[model samples]
Target: MRIYELGDGTPEVSVVGAIHGDEPCGERAIERFVDEEPTVERPVKLIVANEEALDAGRRFIDEDLNRAFPGDPDADTHEGRLAHALSREIRGTTVLSLHSTQSYAEPFALVDEVDAVTRSICPHLPIEYLVETGRFSEGRLIEHAHTVEVECGLQGSEEAAANAYWILRAFLSATGVLPAPVAGDTEPPLSLRRRDADEVVVFRLLDQIPKGPAEEYRVFVDNFQRVAPGDRVAAADGEAFSADTEFYPVLLSANGYDDVFGYAADRVGTLA
Candidate 1:
């Protein structure tokens, strides 16, 4: 983990990046923002996690760091040890952890569950959707209180990097680490802007859309779109599976995960 601190005193606001080495957008955004030497209203810690995996240019050296949170210091895996250390650094802080995804090209936010912090911070973010991970939170960093995880865009894309930077600025602004962004002051890329009279749609993870072993896999539905009962959702080796009930595809994509295509989510409500 590499940490950069701005202003004075122990930071209660933090921005984390590069938790998964395969997603470089977060690291790029953090580095670019630090290069500007922007002044902050309060102390903040910016961290680039999983340096060893990042250096190796792989998803992880031993295991996925995001799934290894509150890790054991004496754990055997590299991610396990790193997770323990990273957890300590961000403990008691309101955090923004950056990430990119293969399932969606648009940015979205995720939290362990919607709360006062979610209501307060998510609206200021440049996103149209907020996900409640619920039981799926497991060992993820968002399982920690007051932490928000963002899927900036398609993994490793330049657009994702740009989105990550702006998202970081928005998070800091919402947390009072930086001043609020003004309209016509600076243009945001990819049509990203703060919520203006728009309510963010909230989705709760209901279950994982499991995938079976197949030589070829294909998805027939667009993510975030509602799937009706008996609609063909995906195919594996020429065999198609249809949904038995209604659902909104969250992170649905072909070849995104080994054991699952993505998640099945329900549109819970809107966060204004």
Candidate 2:
């Protein structure tokens, strides 16, 4: 991990990038921030994590770093030690971990729970959807207090990089680390792009669509859409898999992962 402190005093805000090495949008965003050299009102720490995996252009060297949070420093795996180090770095701080997904092309926020902090910070992001992990957040980075994760956009896309950069700037501005725009500024600062209304759709993760013993699989329903009973969600080995209960697909993807098709979620309610 590479740490860049962009002001004096103890850092109260942190932005972590490249938790998954294959997702480089966050890293690109961080690099752009560094290049701009924006003056911050408060101290902030920018971390480029999983450098080894990033160098190799793989997800990770041994394990998924995002899944190995609060890890052991004495562990054998590289990610375990890195996770431990990262946990220490962002202890007691408001953290924003950046990520990209194959299932969604638009940015969205993810949190362990919808608390005061989440409610405040999520609206500052350029996202209309907020997914509360519930039990599914067990080992994620967002499991930690005051930490929020975001899927910026589709992995490796230019749009994803732009989204990540804008979101990071917005997060900093919202958190008061970066100053808001002044009068007569030609372009609108990131803070201005934040959703004015408090209406945000919240989705609670229900279950995962586990991949069974099959040669191939395909997903039909669009993500974030309601999947009614008997609606065909996916297919494996030419056999169709329909929803048995009313649910919404969040990360529904055909070949996104090997162990599961994606996730089934329920629209809990809107957050204001």
TM-scores of all candidate predictions against the true structure: 0.98, 0.94
Candidate 1 local lDDT, 1-272, one digit each (tens): 99999999989999999999999989999999999999999999999998888888899999999999989999999999999999999999999999999999889999999999999999889999999999999989999999999999999899999999999998999999998878776857746764453789999999999999999999999988999999999999989999999999998999989999999999999988
Quick one: best TM-score, which candidate? Answer: 1
Candidate 2 global TM-score: 0.94
lDDT winner among the candidates? 1
**What is the lDDT of every predicted structure here?**
0.93, 0.88
Span of ten consecutive residues with least summed lDDT in model 2:
186-195
Model 2 accuracy (lDDT, Cα): 0.88
lDDT for 5 in candidate 2 is 95
Q: What ranges in model 2 sit over 4 Å off?
A: 181-198
RMSD of candidate 1 to the true fold?
Answer: 1.2
Clashing pairs in 2: none
Please give the distance, in angstroms, between residue 224's alpha carbon in candidate 1 and its true position after superposition. 0.8
